[model samples]
Target: MEMIVHNPTEGIYAATDDFVHAIEVRSPSRFLFIAGTMGLDSDGVPGTTLEEQLELIWANLRVILAEAGMSVDNIVRLTSYLRDPSYAEANAKARVAALGGRRVPTTAIVAQTLASGWLVEIEVVAAG
Candidate 1:
């Protein structure tokens, strides 16, 4: 599949280079909409630290993508929710590592809280 990132010249640019304004997937044979994944482990234990939680969230996303025979590169869009503004940097760092520098269309929102002390939650849309 060919994924095109669109950043129109007339629109405001993203604050970070990690994402584009929009994404277009061409001739997708299949599409996957992943639910908001939290920073919990297999045993239902939430990570204690922001960094730890971010890492776990990425790991969980990777597993979900793998199960669908996809990878981070197949992702066309990403949405993230964070409990605190302080966790933004950590979240970006973890996302960069997880995506391996592939900048897909993304949206991030800062929220008050999440269930079970999760610092972050991520949702993805992939096409292949």
Candidate 2:
């Protein structure tokens, strides 16, 4: 299966680096809709900072993907929920690092709160 990323010329360009407006997955693909994942470890301890939480969330996503026989390259979309707007940059940084610069269509929402003490939550859609 192959994923095609599209950024139409007529649409407003994405403000962030390494991001696309949309992604298309070709036929013969299997899709996975992962539940919103937080930054909690196996012991249920959350990360202390925005960056730390973002990193942990990304790691958790990777584990979920791997369990489905998919890797970050198979991800077509990502949605991030942050407790504070200040965490946006850290979110982007962790995403880029986790995907190794591959640009996946993404949406980031600054929310009033997320699960108890979680600083960030991320959900992903992958095709394989």
Q: Pick the candidate with the highest TM-score.
A: 1
lDDT, model 2: 0.84
Alpha-carbon RMSD, each predicted model: 1.5, 1.6
lDDT of 1 by residue, 46-76 (tens): 9999888888888898899999999888988
lDDT for model 1, please. 0.85
User: CA lDDT of 119 in candidate 2?
Assistant: 82
Weakest lDDT window of 10 consecutive positions for candidate 1 = 9-18
Cα TM-score of candidate 1: 0.92
lDDT of 2 by residue, 29-55 (tens): 588999989998878889887776777
Q: Which residue ranges in model 2 land beyond 4 Å of their true spot?
A: 114-116
